[model samples]
Each structure stands twice: as structure tokens, then as C-alpha cells.
Target: MKTTIAYLATATALVALATAAQAQDKKTLAIVVKGLDNPFFEQINLGCQKWMSENADSEYQCLYTGPASSADEAGEVQIVDDLLTSGVAAIAISPSNAPAMANRVREIAPDVPVMTIDADFLEADRDLRTTYLGTDNYLMGVKMAEEAAKLKPEGGTVCLQLGNVAADNINARAQGFRDTAGGAEGIERLAGEGGWTEIEGCPVFTNDQADLANQQMADTFIANPDLDAFILVGGWAQFAPQAYSQVTDQVMDKLNSKELIIIAGDTLPPQTQAFRDGRSHAQVGQRPFEMGYKAPDVMIQLIEGQTVEDPLYTGLDVCNQDDPGFCKDN
Candidate 1:
């Protein structure tokens, strides 16, 4: 009877392993971003689909998801938990809050690979992720500063407009701006413009809220007429049709005439259209599609026993009015 029981247990163990292998073959990848309301994340979603179609031999599938905005840190964490429960082979997250997600990433790292794209965790929790696939955020900041300096060589007051000031990537970009164009070369930052709440030079969160972004933008331009330029580190306003109307009516002409310069991040259709129509000046375009495209490739690489030699950072292409090809193609 003991021999019979042992044989039955061994057979059951083999069957369980076979079942787990089958599940892995059918496992889906979750590409989670900060929010879904924006086109950057949509490009990421498209990129994933495109890649999967091209790599049919890999047999990998992906699901793109996000919360309402970049401010929803808890919502983002919950998405990760949900993906974990759903049995994803791997997870690629563009966290709204890196430090906040560190523990969660750490908790699941042993079971499956967890990597970061776009924004990354603080140094202490950096190892929680299997790899980081995005730009050197600080370099992106430096690039923005260089472009701003190039545009307004005469130097004037500039203010920052962005989302989620608490993010590490946001702070890194802000610091990069400080290091690159923190008013050292005669350009003054609009210090506490009109006594609005200031955190890393961004008074209003915008929360990716079009109306609020437009309102804050109009107020900033109207409040400080001589405000010279805007460095939208996380360019949230340009997404909405109604967004920046007042700024366009009142301030965009300055941009068109080269009197006022606006440099934004993330190039989407809205950005392309605005640049074409002279609503905004230039975009320090972060390729969300490319980031999205690489995300699945990276995850599949790990899933299939391939190695990541480097972080696989995306390029920051600056699409001014002169070149909207990238925008149109995207």
C-alpha cells in the first residue's frame, strides 16, 4: 500500500509540472503605464501589438493598462497586484511613484520578472526591478535645458509645467533643468509666479486634467506676461482639444512670432497638430511607441532565456515645427 501511494504521488507531481508549463506557454504580458487618457501610453500599446505580430514565433501576448492619471499612485500599485493575480509571465510598469511601488516589486521579484520603463525607482530600491528600459531621465532634462537655451539665447524668465512632481523621473528632469538651465545663464525661473503653490517649479498638478492645465497655463501666461518660455517637463495640457485655448489665443502668437517659446515633452498627435498649427513651439519627444515596443521584447527576452546587455533606453527626438515626420508616422 505504501509503494502504491508513493507511485501515485510521483505521477501527480509530474502532471502538476506539465500543467504549469502549459500555463507559462499561454502566459500574457502586462504593460502598465501611468495613465491611459494620454496618447503616449497608446503608442506604447500599439508598439506592443506591432511587436507581437512581428514576432509570432515567440508566441507572446500583451495587455496595456493604466489608471486615470499620473497622480493615481495607489491605482497603479493595485494594477500591479491585479496583474500578478492574473498570472502574467512578466510585468513592465511605468510607475507614477517608484518608491511607493518598490516593496510591491520586491515582493514579486522572486516569482516573476518585474521591470521598469519610463520612470524608475529611487536608488535604494533600484534593484527591485529586473531592468530599467527607458531614457536616462536626467539626460532628457539636460537636453530640454539645452534646447531652451538654444531657443532663447537672450535669456528671459521661464516656468515649468508638468505632472506629478513627486516622481523620481520628474525630480531628475527638474534637477537636470537646474543643472542645465537653472537660470545660471541669465534665464530666470519664474520663481513663485503670482504666489501660486510651487513644488519643483510646478504649482498645479494638472493631474493630466485638460481644463485645469489650460486654466493654470492661461493664468500663468496672463499673470506673468513677460514669462518668456515654458518647459513642460511632462506636457499634459496639449492632449485635450480645449486645452491651452486661452494660451493659444493670448500666448501662442508669441510662440509663432518667436517672441515666446514653449518646449514640451512627449510627442503625440496633439503635439504634432499643435506644432503644425503653431500652438506650441517644440516637443522634446520621448518615444512612447518605441518604449512600448521594446517593453514586450524585453519581457519576452527574459521569458525565453535571453539576456539584457543594457537598459535599452529610447531616443529623445526633438520635433520642432520644421520636422513633424516622426509625429505623423506615429
Candidate 2:
């Protein structure tokens, strides 16, 4: 009877191990970005999917979903909800609006681990997420300003194109630029026809909007033809050299010269090309692919009883034409 009981116990243990293996094998991870249309996010999603497939023993699935348009927060919320309902074990998101989405996110998937990448849910509850993996927006701003200072050692009026006013991450980057530029002696941030807000710089389908904003930039250039530098909170300002070239002869002339200093955030392929073509001086490389590859690896660690930390900033870089790793080596 003792031998029979021992045999029964061993079978039970084997069954438990099999069950656990099946559970791990069936788990899925969902990634939701701000928008699927953005090529930057596309690269990130691709990296995540690659990691999931390569690490198949983890039994993880990667699902990527986003809004149709960059501004579609409601669509993002719905996607998050759907992912939760689909029984994902983990989720990583680039939040669209932290304040509005926090409560909903917590309510829908209270136990599943959630993370933010590239951007964060700043207004969410302290415990609302398992981790935030991306660049520190404030530091990125300071870097941009430092580059700005290098361009005009004497300092001059700098026009900032702040993008996505609804995004706290972008706003923090903008605020960082504002704070740093103010402290730099001789750097004067213009007002009225001077600095453009995110709402003002937000892109629309209209080419006229681009033309109008370019005219506004030209008008500012007219007032201070000496406007020697520009700091974009993101990639928005990178477009200025082209638009301003068409609108003002002065800007056209300086497009290829050292007269204009352009610095921005997030070095994407197009942005890298833009820099190579002399449209932007430097870019803060957020390293989206690294972030993508790391997120699942961290989640796997969590499943294996390893503790994951909050606010894990994967990697960051400053890139220009000469930097060997500025863009993809390819």
C-alpha cells in the first residue's frame, strides 16, 4: 500500500508539471502602440514579434494593435480592452492619454502585467504598471538644448515645434527644452509669432496647413533672420527646413549652410535620412528595437520568479552623421 501511494504521488507531480508547461506554452503578450501608421512604432512591433517567435519555449504570443490615426485614443482604449478580453498574460503600450485611460486600463485587466514603451502613462496610479521602458523625456530635452547652444554659441531666437499636446511624454520633452533654453544665457525664446504650440504644429491632411505653418515660420524668420537654431520637441521641426525653404528665400539659402541648427528626438529611418540629407543636425536615438526586444525578455524573467523593476530605461543614444551607430548599420 505504501509503494502504491508513492507511485500515485509521483504521477500527480508529473501531471502538475505538464499542466504548468501547457499554461506557459499558451500564454500571449499584447503590444499596443499610439498608432500603427507610424513607421517608428512598426519597427518596435516587428522587434517584439521577432523575440516572441525566437523564444518559443516561453510559449508567448505577440499581438500588435493600434489606432487607425495618430489621434485615435478611443480606438487605442478599445484595442487595450480587446487584448485583455483575449486573455493576454502581459501587455506593453505607448499610452495615448494617461489621465483618461488609467482607470479603464486598471479595471479591465487588473492582474495582467502592463508596461509602457517609448511613452508612458504619467497620470496613472503608481502601481498601475509593471514597468516603463523608454528614454527619459526630460533628459532628451536637455540634450537637444545643449546641441542648440553649440550651434549658436552667442545664442539667438530658437523656434520650438512641440508635437502631440495630448501626450504627456512629448509635453515633458517640450517643457525640458523650455527650462534648459531659458537657463542658457543669451538664448531668447520668442513669443506670439515666435514659439509654436503642439496644437499649432499638429499635422492635418491639408497641405495648406503646412504652407500656413511655413509662412508663420517665414514670418518669424523675417523678424529675426538671425534665428540661427531650432529645437524640435520631436520630429516635427525636422520638416521645417523643407517647408521654410519653399516659403522664404532666406531659409532656402540657409538650408545647406551652417546658419540653421536643427536638433530633434527619436532617430527613425526617415529621420536618419533627413539628417544625412542635411535637414537635421542631430537626433536623440530612443533605440526602439532594443526596447522591443527587451520587453518580452523582462516579462519572461517575471514569469520565472525574477523580480522586474519599475521604469526600466533600456538604452538611449545621440546620433549625427559621423556616429558609426547613428542609424541602422545597414
Candidate 3:
């Protein structure tokens, strides 16, 4: 009995050592987003998983992880810090708060390759990341503004909806919209420039909460009944299809008559359906799946000391009710 117990303990120790060795042999390529709850991020996660499955023979393993809540900026930073020391070979982050993430990245000064996906750091802090792989956010905003202009030739009162206040991508999109719609570069807000004026209590920040986003829209409409257009720099409200449908339903007549133009970001399934249902006018989408799919390869290249583009753009998809071909199948 004593001999058998000793033998079993030895076997367990050997197994544990083998498991540790196997784990160390495989390097992790992690893609960290703002939150896992958001479907937009989920699409990216799917693409990461696809890459992992296809490259099963490779020494690298892909990991998709993030905070439980999109609003948890600290959580995202903490995850990045943990991953930096946790045997991750490479990391691609979609920063929840640009400046905060930049600070963390700068502090860690990680030895491994680091890249930014979806949201990027502020321009001054761009050097912190090896590359940026995502949409040309400014151009997306410009496109959205163009769509709004097409619907309302002579610009009028408008409200801009955005995600996290400190997110660089969201800020870039806002800048693009303001610059285009106001007909001047670096125009912060439209007072009377280019016949456009942001309504009082305008440019509402949602903090990436779908419910709050929808409520803000409804409240804005109630307060400013004569508002001409509503622009969403991120698809916050529309992510919750049911709530969005209910809110937009109230203004269906205005949408149909083109009295209230609504142009939002991202052409997700539900957002596309919203366009079909006449809840929104146009959608300027970012290719998040493409970003996820390409991230692992890009990281591998970086790790191998191969040259890659600094800002590897994934491009955009423009969808509108008038342009059926542009819209994706729901």
C-alpha cells in the first residue's frame, strides 16, 4: 500500500510537469477589446477563433478577452497589464480609454510586440504601439456626414451621439463629422457654419451603454422636437434592436418623410435591419471581423521581425436605404 501511494504521487508530479512544459511551448497571441458583451467585439472574437483553428499546428495560440462591461475602462487596462506579464507573446488592444491605455502601455514598455486594434491611442502617443489595424475612423465620420448632407441639403439642427468620451476613435469620427458638415477643417462645433448648428444639450456621450444611448436619443427628440438630424458615431442604441425599434418607431413618419435624418456607425445585422425598417437612414461600418482575422498574422510578422504597415487599415462599408447593394444581408 505504501509503495502504491508513492508511485501514484510520482505519476501525478510527472503529469503536472508535462502540462507546464506544454503550456510554455505554446505562445499566446491575445486580442483584447473593450468588452466581450458587445456583439461588435464578439464578431472580432469569432474571427480570432477562426484564425486559431486554421493555424492549429502553429506554436502561437490566439486569445480573445476583455472586460465584462464596455464602460469598465480600468478593467481593460488591468487586463492588459496582467497579459503583459502572463506569458503572452503578443497583444493587440482596442482601447476603451485612449489616454489611460496609452499611459499603461508606456509604463509597461512591454518587450513583446504590441498593437492597437479598433480604437487607437491619441496622435501624440501613437509611437507606443507598433501598428494600428482598424477603420479610418475620420473617413467613416466624413462619410456619415456626407450621407446626412445628402438627405438634408441645407444643414439644420443636429445631435451627435458618441461612445466613451476619451476613446480616440470616437473623437476622430466626431472631428471628421464636424469638419465636413461645418465645411471647414478643425471646426469643433457647428454654430452657423455651412448652415449647420448643433442643438442645445447636443453631442451626447453614451459611455457605450445601449440602454442609456436609446434613452438619450428619446430625450433629445422630446426636448428638441424640431431637430433635423441625429448622427451616431457608434452603434450604441441600435445594438439593442428591440429598444431601438421602439424608440425609432415613434419618429417613423419623420424618418419616412426625410424630415429627421439618422445616420449611424457600424453596419451590424440589427443596424442593417434598422435601416430596412426605416429606423435609420444610413450606416457607415467598420470591418471588425477583418481586424480580428488579420491581427494574429500581423502579430506573428512583428514577432518574426518582418516589415508591416504602421497603420494597416481594414477599410469601411457604407450602407443606405437608397443603395441596396451596399447593405449586407440581415
Candidate 4:
């Protein structure tokens, strides 16, 4: 009986040593968000780090990456290439340009799960990426249009300031906006009616530059002071302080009088607080936190040869000053 007990303890020790060895050989998972400056992407970073902390026992190493420029498709592609060469266990990315990124993901998807966040691959190459986890951007746009109509009940002229013209989300959002706010799409029409007119130099591309977006807004406002509402598809300039430099002091004051309606999509701490500070009428938020958090889990599951939800979706959380959840603990 003594010999049997000793043998059982020895086997258990061997198993424990093997487990430790495997634990040390963790697979590296890479998460690439949109831009370093964007707060929305920062939330994704939080999610990734949070997932790593909660699953401290797992054999996974998380790497979070962000680019300096939001419009740099080549830069995003290079990130994917670098991760692939470094032999990452899996990869999750927010593509700047879906059409540009489609081929790059094709090279790596067969070997690892190339989960996409925020935006997705083009229609033809949608199969390249393993799965997509993001908000229904079209519906988000519709929501924005709905809000715009509510504010300008008399019907007013509105212009949309767009960022990264190549981004899939931006395009879908524009179409959705047109469907409800700008033009007739034969839909149920939840928002603006014929009372709303779209400006010609409208949908001015900002390229996601802080100064440039501010300049565009300031210039457009100078040209069309009567511009009643603006649907900021992405809050590019609002992220930094320079965003205030270009707009004239008089124009900036209009936000308080409710003369101009500015509704933005994708809320982070800064943007939400900006809303709270009365920068805009309302903010429709995308769950980048969930995107960042779930991305790692999905990638790890793929690495472990397990099944995950195909095309996982994070949702939009909208709020105003009146809502209890309005930027709570932001």
C-alpha cells in the first residue's frame, strides 16, 4: 500500500510539471485597433487587456496595436503582415479600408483566425476573414438620421462630415443616412422628409485628420452659416484640442443655443464627455469595448481548435443628457 501511494504522488508531480511547461509556451494573440488617438479604439484596448487579465490562467499572450493615422490602409496591411511573419496564434483587426485589406487577410486566414472588428472585408472577399464582430453601422446611421429629424422638426439643411472615405463603415453609414435623412430610399422613412436638403459640397471627406476635420467644418460653416445640422459619421476632430482652433468663436457658441445640431457616432470617454459638455445634441455609441474584449476570446478559441460564434456582433449604445446611463463613469 505504501509503494502504491508513492507511485500515485510521483505521477501527479509529472503531470504538474508538464502542465507548467505547456503554460510557459503560450501562443501570442495580436489585436490591431483603428488609431492611437481615437478613444473608441482605446476602449478596444481596454477590452483586450481586460480579457487577458480575467483569463490569467490561459496560455495566451495578448498584443494590442494601433496606428497613428486613421486613414492609413497600407499601415494596417503592414500590421497584419508583421503579425503573420512573427507567427501569431491568431489575429483580430479593425481595417481602415476593407477593399484594400481583403487580399492581405486572405494570405493569413487559412492558418489562423483573422477576425475583423469595426469594419469588414469587401463583399467579394468577405470569406477571407474568419469572422466579423462589429456594430450594424447602417442601423446606426438610421438612428442618427432619426435623431436629426426629431431636432429639426421644421426640416432644415444638413451636411454630413465623413472620415476615411474608403472605410466600409463610413460608406454604409452614408447610405443609411441618405436612406432616412437626405434622400428617399422608399423605406418606412423614420427621419427627415423632403424638408431636409443636402448641401452640394456635402459629405466632405475629412480623411480622419483632427485639424483637417476642424478646418472642413469651420470652412463649411463659414460658407453655409445656415447649416442647421451635421451628422458626424465619425468624431475625428473632436478627439483632440486642435479641433477647436479652426472654428470661429461665434460658430462654436451655436451649440449651446441649439441652433446647430451635431450628432456623432462611436462614443468614447472623450466624445461622451464632449456630449455631456454640450458639444452635440446626442451621441450614438458603438461598443468598441466589447469588440476589443471579445476579439481575444474569439481568437483564442480559434487557436484552441474550438468553435466560436461566426460573425459575432457588438451593438450600439445611444445616450443623451437625459438618460441615466449618460456617460456614467466614463
Candidate 5:
């Protein structure tokens, strides 16, 4: 009887080991983000790639693809379709829209689970999504408003440069910032006309010739030098120095007292450098890399028929020059 009991225990241990090994042998996952031109996405991709390589026991792979800019929804769609055809076990995406792509993702990868990161699709069918991993957009907006209010407690004309207003993520943030500061005394929201464009998308040679769109931004600032603050809905402030360099030498004195507090939604390497160099006031940062790192793991768990959470609300923090010593913490 004792020998039988020992034999049963040993068999159970062996089975458990074998199951663990099988779990590690899962196939690769497809992680499609918006664009790599932005360091935020690149950093996230790097984290995902690093985690996959380091965990050699896992047979997972990451299929990374996106356009040079986030505006290329067709390009993103093509990549997702291709990955679906290529037999990836699952896919993670920062989708362009909720209705348009959600249906297509369902049509293409019918059996596979789709996880939305950073940007969630509003019309996405519950069955198509295993989880939504990203920040609570409305809350972040409120946070931005609070920060912006602190800069101009009395409320002045605050201009908002909404980046990709079509994208729900940016829109939510813009609205959040608005709601946060809407009630403040003398606070006025001056909506600016602009969207997300590549930094290199518009480069200046001698800071004299105005790139059309940037010129418009400069004009707005010049017109409203008294504007209490300029809120960049995305990390659009990173492009400001280059834009301002166009007229700084001419109007340094004018800008000295203007006190246009610049606030942004996310932190990229350039934006981080901007804050360090005194170009921006504050940046909301997230552990963007971890999104890439965990994207595949979450997908793998779903593919293996293991239960995964329906949504994972990640966090983002604010960073300024004061916290330069802890850039990593941000």
C-alpha cells in the first residue's frame, strides 16, 4: 500500500511537469501597434520583443507591423489580415476604430481572441475581445485638467492641440482635460486646429520658413501670447521647440512672460528630453513597454484555453524636470 501511494505521487509530479512544459511550447503571437516612429510605441515593442526572447521556454513569437504613422488604418488592417492568415494563435492591437476594424478582425480571425491595447474599439464585440489593456482615458483627462488648472488657477485662455481627434484615445484625453478645467474661474478652452503628424514629417531648415501647419500653431501662440496654457493632447509638445525655434530669436522677449504652460498626454524619448531641456512643463507617461511585454503572454494564455481577464487597466504617471533623477520611474 505504501509503495502504491508513493508511485501515485511520483506520477502526479511527472504529469504536472509535462503540463508546464506543454504550456511553454505555445506558438507565436501577433502584436500590431500604431507606429514605430514614436518612441512610445517603439519602446513598447522593444519590451515585448525582449520578454519573448528572454522567455526561451515559451514558443511564442511577436509579429510587429505598423505604418510610419498612426493614420494608416488600411496598412494596419492589411497586417492584421495577413497575421490571421499566417496562423498566429492570437493578435493584440491598438485599433484605428471600434466598428470598422472590429468586424473585420472577427471576420478574419474568427476563432482567435483579439486583445485591444492603448486604444479600445467601442463597437468591438465582447466575444472578439479577450481583454482591453490600457489607461482609463476619461480619468487621465481629469488628471491633465487638474495639472493644467494648477498652472493657471485663475483660468485664462487655454489652447488645446488635439492630436488625432478621430482616435478615441486622444479624444477622450482632450475631453478629460476640458472637463477638468471647465469649471475654473476665467478658464476658456481655445480649440486649436491640428492633428498628429510625424515630427520628421515637418522639418525646418533655418527656423525662418514656416511649415504651413506649424506656422498656424505659431500664429495661434503669437496671437494669444497671453494664452494661459497650451495643452498638447498627445506628446505633441515634443514638436514645439522645433516649431518655436522658427521665431524664438525674434520673439524671446515676448515669450518670456507669456507663461503658456505646455502639457501632453504621453511621454516619448524626445518629449522626455524636451522636459529635461525646459521646453515642456509636464508629460503623462505609462509603462508603455510592458504593454508589448505582456501582450503576447496574455494572448498565449487565451489560446491555451486558460481563462484571461476581460480587461486590464494599466497606469500612466506624470513627469517633469523635477523628476529627472527618476525618468525610469515615470
Candidate 6:
């Protein structure tokens, strides 16, 4: 009886050791976004999952996580801090608050490879991350403004809608739009530059709240009946399809008449549908899937001590009612 018991105990010990070894063999490549609530990030998550699926035999596994709400900048920062100590082999972050994120990243000074996806740290603090993998946000804004210029050459009263006030990517896009449409670099507000004037109380900040974004648009139109163009540097309002549709419905007549040109960033399905429905004028989209798909490979390269390009651009997609072929269900 004693001999049998010893044999069983030794077998269990060996099994436990083997399981621990297996667990240690598998390293985690984590992608943390601003929020899990946004479908845009969900697309990124799907792409990350695709990479994991295609590399099922690999020892590295991809983990996708984020704050429950995009507005939770502190929550996102805390998550990054937690993941840094959680044995992740590498981390890819889409910062919700550029400055705050950079501060935290600097504090932690994580030993693992860190890169920014979708959004990046402000230029001053860019060294916090190894590289950025996402859209050329400035060019995206320039393209949107160019489309608006094409539709309304004389440039009229315009309003720019943006995401978080401190988000680096959104700021870059906003600056690009202002520079292109206003025809003057570094102009804060369009005061008749390039025949464009940004109305008072314009350039509303949404903080990534879809409902609030929709309300802000409605209020802007109500306030400025002569508002000529509305530019969204991010897809906050359009993410809430129903609310956005309703808000745009109130301005359909203007949209149809081309009196109010609404050019937005991101070509999400709902935004595309809005264009098809003649609610918005055009969409300038970033390749979120490509960002997610390519991030893992970049992380792997970093892990292997291989040099990768900084600020790797995924590319953009522009579509309009006249050019429907450019927009597809992403």
C-alpha cells in the first residue's frame, strides 16, 4: 500500500511540472486598445485573433484587452501597468490620453518591447514606445479637407469635430484639416483663411462619447444654421448608427443640396451606410485591421532584436457618394 501511494504522488508531481513547463513555454503578445466597447477596436481584436489562429503552432499567443469604456483614460493606463507585470512578452497600446499614457510609460519603463497601435504618444514623448503602427493621421485629415475643398471650392463656414482633447492622433488630424482647409499652416481657427471661417464655439471635443458627439452635432447645426461644412476627425458620432442617422436626418436637406458638406474620418459600416443613404458627403478611413494584423509581426521582430520601421503606416481608404467603390464592409 505504501509503495502504491508513493508511485501515485510521484506521478502527480511530474504532471504538475510538465504543465508548468508548457505554460512557461507560451509567451503572451498583448494588444491593449482604448476601449473594448468600440467596434473599430473590435476589428483590430479580430485581426489579432486571426494572427493567433494562423500561428497556432507558435509559442507566442496574442491577448487583446482594454478598458470597458473609451472615456476611461485612467483605466487604460492602469491596464497597461498591470500587463507590464503580468509576464507579457510584448505590448501594443492605442493610447486614449497621449500625455498621460506617455507619463505612465515613462514611469514604468517596462523591460518588454512596447509599441503604439492606432494612436501614439505625443511627438515630445514618442520615445516611450518602440514604434507606431497605424494611419498617417495628418494625411487622413488632409484628404478629408481636400474632398471638402473639391465639393465646395470657395470654402465656407466649417466646424471640426474631434475625439479626446489630448489624443495625439486626433490632434494631428485636426491640425491637418485646419491647415488644408484654411490654407494656412498652424492656424488655430479658420478666420477667413482660404475663404473658410470656423464659426464661434466650433471644433467641439467629444471625448469619444457617441451619444454626446451626436448631440454636439445637432446643437452645432441649431446654433449655426449657415454652417457650410462639418468635419469629423474621428468616428465618434457615426459609431452610434441610430443616433447619427437621426441627427443627420435633420440636416438631410442641406446634405442633398450640397450646402452642408459632411466629411468624416473612418469608413466603418455604419458611416458607409450613412454615405449611401445620402446623409454624409465623404469618408476618409484608416486600416484598423491592417494595424492589428501587422502589430504582432512587428512585436515579434522587436522581441528578436530586429530593427523595424518607426511610425509604420498602414494606409488609408477614401470613399464618397460619387466614388462608392472605395468603401467596402470592413
Candidates in descending lDDT order: 3, 6, 4, 1, 2, 5
The CA lDDT of each predicted structure is 0.70, 0.63, 0.87, 0.73, 0.61, 0.86
Q: Please, what is the TM-score per model?
A: 0.81, 0.75, 0.92, 0.83, 0.75, 0.92
Task: Indicate the TM-score of model 3.
Answer: 0.92
For TM-score, candidate 2 versus 3, the one ahead is 3
Question: C-alpha displacement of 138 in model 5, angstroms?
Answer: 2.0
Q: Give candidate 6 regions above 4 Å deviation.
A: 1-24, 328-330
- Candidate 1 yields a Cα-based lDDT of 0.70
| Cα lDDT of model 3 by residue, 14-108, tens digit | 34533553676877888989976789999898889899789988998777887777877877887788778655779999999999999988998
At residue 144, candidate 5 shows an lDDT of: 75
- Tens digit of per-residue lDDT, candidate 5, span 1-330: 543444344335434533554466656576777654455677778878788688766666665555555555555666567557755678788876555667788787557878888777764365678787778786787777776665657666656665443466666676566656664323233232121111211121111112433464566666765655666666543544576455334444543444666666677666666666555567776667778877877887878889877678778787754454334433
lDDT score, candidate 3, position 110: 92
Tens digit per residue, CA lDDT, model 6, 1-330:
543444344335434533553576877788888877788898898899899889988888777777777887877887788778655789999999989988988998899999999998999998878899999999998998899999999999999999888888998898898899887799788889989898898789998889999999999999998989999888889999999998988989999999999998888788888878887888998888888888899999999999899989999989876677666453
Instruction: Kindly indicate the candidate among 2 and 5 with the higher lDDT.
Output: 2
Instruction: State which candidate has the highest lDDT.
Output: 3
RMSD of each: 9.8, 12.1, 7.7, 11.5, 13.3, 8.9
Q: lDDT for model 5, on a 0 to 1 scale?
A: 0.61
Q: Give per-residue CA lDDT, model 1, range 1-330, as digits (tens).
A: 543444344335434543554666856677888866666678888998888788766656666776655556677776677667656789888888777777776776547778888888887887777788887777787777777767776556777766775577776776676566654432234343322112344445666556677777787877777667777787777877566655677876688777778777777777777767777677777877888788987887877777785567787877765566566554
Find the 10 residues in a row with the least total lDDT in model 3.
2-11
Of the candidates numbered 3 and 6, which has the greater TM-score value? 3
Clashes of each: 0, 0, 0, 0, 1, 0
Residue 14 lDDT (model 3): 34
Best by TM-score: 3
